[model samples]
Target: MTERDELVPRRRRDRRGRGMRGPAVQPLAATGHRPPLPRSRREVFDKIMLDVVTDIDARWSEHLGLVEYAVEDAPQLPDDWDSGRVPLSSLVRGSGTTPTRLVVFRRPLEHRAADRADLEAIVLALVVEQVAELLGIEPHDVDPRYPSDLDDD
Candidate 1:
């Protein structure tokens, strides 16, 4: 036979170089439960915040109930804001018929963190700071584990 007549199509090759032609199929794991996929970054951030809030609430039930927690993608920096200055978080005081609110900027915090542990620490600290403000106390007083100076970053 001529070279062209004997040639095999590129798509038909199998591991053993046999001309087995069919669609590829993925095999399912034999294990009863496959591991869950990792959570998205925003979901992880939300979970970390929720865990922190739950812990704080359990310890300080009286003050935590009146506060509302929220997460925004990022802070709205003013148009003329100075260079090298950005607000990572904020706390809003309640008005008539409104509850005090703590807002944590997710993007900024995620950008600042080097890893998941760092992100958790930053989130916890921000919550502690906002809770402290609402309670008219120091951040450390709100959570003894809070860093002495969270101002470094």
Candidate 2:
């Protein structure tokens, strides 16, 4: 073999086994900025839920004592379910010595929302409606931000 052939470096293999891949340097690492936080859809939904619950509790914590809030991936529906649409949330009133529980179904709410802002609106609306039911008051009384156009029917 010619010396010239030996002097030429062999090309590095990539993911495809064809050519080079990946960035020369990771984007944020080179800039001296910290990496962005990693969050999943469920995490995002939970944060939104926490914000809404905190706001509602500030106003009605006295009237609605010992309430439990939760976020589930999706609700279990029976085969004979009659509703035209799936439920985005569920509320179970507590009896004597039991705390009331409110559950937000994350998948259904995420599916119905078009974007982040819409998701926030939907979460707020559901919480307001549930709180209204618990307190036996209008949703508007529960939160002025409750969407005016949301239909109860």
Candidate 3:
């Protein structure tokens, strides 16, 4: 073997190399080719939520009795940002004004999940829960077909 090859450890140089690994795995709903990696768990969650919020707005616009509704990122509160800041994914109550809004915090949701699949499940569940609360009904009532035993069936 070459002198250089002997100097460098075998583990450091493989088909996978130092950083690159196997092919990227794309989320099922992803439209385009897979990215090298998701920008971050939070970014992926945010993208997913954007699509979800759009669908919800379209589906519930009429039921809401208003032409316009808002879905936005929650503000990060000042103080020790590490702990004191409120997360970006929370839905906060708005003033009882003309247009209503539903906020979703991204960071907190990302932090809650162990992986991408878990993140997606948590996001879906959270959306359903939020919508149910907004409509003043139980989560099951919103969609009677909503799965009961989420783990089994």
Of the candidates shown, which would achieve the greatest lDDT relative to the real structure? 2
Worst 10 residues of 3 by lDDT: 65-74
Which one wins by TM-score: 2 or 3?
A: 2
Number of colliding residue pairs in model 1:
0
Error of 1 at 18 (Å): 16
For residues 45-77, what per-residue lDDT tens digits would candidate 1 score against the true structure?
999999998899788778655778788998888
| Candidate 3 lDDT, 1-153, residue by residue in tens | 999998997675446555644346445455455566548655676677776667666776666544233334446576656775455444444456645555666666667779887766676666766677677766665554345665232
Candidate 2: RMSD to truth? 5.3
lDDT tens readout by residue for model 2, 47-66:
99999999998999999888
Evaluated against the true structure, the overall lDDT of model 2 is 0.88
Instruction: Estimate every model's Cα lDDT from 0 to 1.
Output: 0.81, 0.88, 0.60
Model 3 misplacement above 4 A:
1-38, 66-97, 143-153
Off by over 4 Å in 2: 1-32, 151-153
Q: List the residue pairs that clash in candidate 1.
A: none
